[model samples]
Target: MGFSDGVIIVLGLALFEIISSIDNAVVNADVLLTMSERARKWFLFYGIIIAVFVVRGLLPLLIVWASSPGVGFMGALTATFSNDASVRDIIERQKPILLAGGGLYLVYLFFYWLFVEPKEYAFFFESHIHRKLSFWFYAVASALLLAVVWITIRINPFIAFGAVVGSTAFFITNGFKHNAEQAEKEIAHSKMTDISKILYLELLDTTFSIDGVLGAFAFTISVPLILLGNGLGAFVVRYVTIHGAKTVRKYRFLKNGAMYSIGSLGAIMLAEAMAVHIPVWTPTFITFIVVGLFFWLSARELKAEKIIA
Candidate 1:
């Protein structure tokens, strides 16, 4: 039970981590390309080390510990180390709150993309729906999720508190991340060292990771499995960041798949928060299914074009 099941859980968790972080990988790749070659190498090395060891490794432990209901931080830590069940018990109790916060953040991200400034970017959404704010459409998605969040809150006050906090944090973080991106753009033109760019990448990583780590609870609550799986996945995500731009270019639809995958993962988190039973493997297959459909359509379009030619 321990060995075989452990292996499956680990692999599943790793895939989830990869799926969740592709957008981050793409953004990181964009940043890395601007740096000098030597600096890029060192930055990636240290970035992976910190992202996995510090962020992926320790952060989950701290979350489980700190978020554990009644126990103080140190007490929770002691429980986590001494008794695994205690960690699981605490997390299970708080799962709704964690899920609510993570899901709302993702919903906010998706709506912000579609609604905030439609003219700046061309999205499929703008062609179909005409509006002043486009935010009303965002409401369609948010309203249902908010309803679920509200229901979850009645059962668990922690979940309500979490959702409110999550919404506020999302608003603040989005602006903060925007500023970071702007600062990065300015630095690209300045005499700043490659170190500056590297630091920016790491900070940028921290923001995305909040959702990734929190969403991880939907899969498994075991700290070692979470760390090992997420650590391995983070390593691959960094590799993908370094070499991913071309891949994304080659299959344009997959980029959309990555984005959709994020939004779907967020929804799943919220549903689970509301006591909806979803399988752990739901994310892995849903992503493949969405991207696969697009891949097939793209291929058919190419073949048809060739025939016409």
Candidate 2:
């Protein structure tokens, strides 16, 4: 895309991101109210920027890099076998940059998931897998699994098995210490102060941003465009949270519908990450339909509640 074309695409993406993120904002508002004003502001500023950076700027770079040569011959081999011209082109043109990008994302996901969802430590009387394993064991397991798949692509079964075992061991051995520290924090903050709650909500918003940003890249690569779309979407979500919270107090069904939308989006994102290509319109249509259905249902429920009173 040319400069002008890129500009237009970016603008459109911004608008799209804004619209998509409205539900996020609504969900955020529900949780944000539990946070202190400072925490809320921190989320509004720092959290949003981090989401845009990781999702829009960082992820594509990683994807492109992973498909490139030298960094990982396995990834290159896969791209070549897949017969995807776009992946091939990215490898040839942007391999080094992409490799660095991908490395960053891997690191980011490791820390993010670790801190976000720490696994509980168990002692004896555990399952076979748990009894002998440390946290790194699971990471090694995942690495081994990937290595097996990578090896299968090259008809090298032994190497694949070795790769999986090696990678799994490396990650598991190194992982979990951070998670252990985070677990302590969670325990100490069990009371869930307003600030803590707001921070939690902000992290939730960041999680929601991952898919939206990734999907936005399927349309355009310009960082500006992705940011624009995400920013607009987040704005709409914030608006909904403010207004919906007020109006939906009497209509529990509306809140339920909103929650359903959030849940569905989360599922859709997971599917997308796994290479499932549900059209963007699917979520867009569901958003409107659910909103309308909730409105109707909420009205009836509220009316019934009044009658009983």
Candidate 3:
């Protein structure tokens, strides 16, 4: 990539990272508010780092490595008889698939953030709001994921693109409004327990970091660059979470705005996965619109609160 292309990619990745992480900030604030200040700081720092590096970066690399022969310790054994083609060809062909998967993940993440209302963890059926899948269900899901990755690796690009698009459609149908409202209500509830809230926040952060890690791959394979992007993005998001949490108590509209921004990102990611071409300016435009609207709404709410006071 040229300097200009590099700049565009970096900025695009940063914008996606920021947008996707907005919901994470809101979720973190809900939990961190209950922790001691020192604990909160520790959680913010370590949590983001782990989410970015371990969960997002290393995990995906492991997935790719496992699915590809000769990328790991089994290399020598496979190398003797494997005619599985060149590493460069594998990387080049897989690039689109990786991008597509990243896009689909973005969409699923959007629905998860927007539509899947955070519920209390329950060991029994009575306490469950969303139906819990059994261990077998999860095992099956994991198998399916592996299969998809394998197929993507071996199949024609058009077929892979179609499958990605189809998945995106299924995810987008889940929508965000219902879950967004539920999260807002939960945040407002006096009975909201801290531990559960913290867990939810951690999960959200991990989800948000997925795109950042994947997008970093588009830049370079250097683990350090990936770490740098993840670290910087996580730091900025933590700051946003802390400040937003402090202010959101007084300006509830900000939380709503942030969630909306996150939802939009999810949408964009899904679109990108489907190979839909969004212009470079689309994210910035969406950010400005959401932020401006939230600011106006927050001002109104603040004024009303002041009047009542």
Q: What TM-score would each prediction reach against the true structure?
A: 0.80, 0.41, 0.52
Error of 3 at 201 (Å): 5.6
RMSD in angstroms, candidate 1? Answer: 3.8
lDDT of 3: 0.52
Better of 2 and 3 by lDDT: 3
Which pairs clash in model 1?
Answer: none
Report the lDDT tens digits of candidate 3 across residue range 1-309: 366544454454454455446555666676567666776776777766776667755654553453343456344223323544565355444445455555444444434433344432222441242354332333443454455545654655543653455356435533443454356446534455655555555654554454455445434433443454555666677787888656645655554454455556545544543446767546546755875687687788789879999
Model 1 Cα lDDT, one tens digit per residue, 42-114: 8778888999888887777777665564666775666556765765566668767777777777767666655
lDDT of each: 0.69, 0.48, 0.52
What TM-score quantifies how close candidate 3 is to the native fold? 0.52
lDDT of 2 by residue, 27-142 (tens): 45556665567876776666656555655555444444443444465554455346666656655444223222222233333333333333322212223334344355446545
Give the per-residue Cα lDDT of candidate 2 at 61: 47
Evaluation by lDDT, superior candidate among 1 and 3: 1
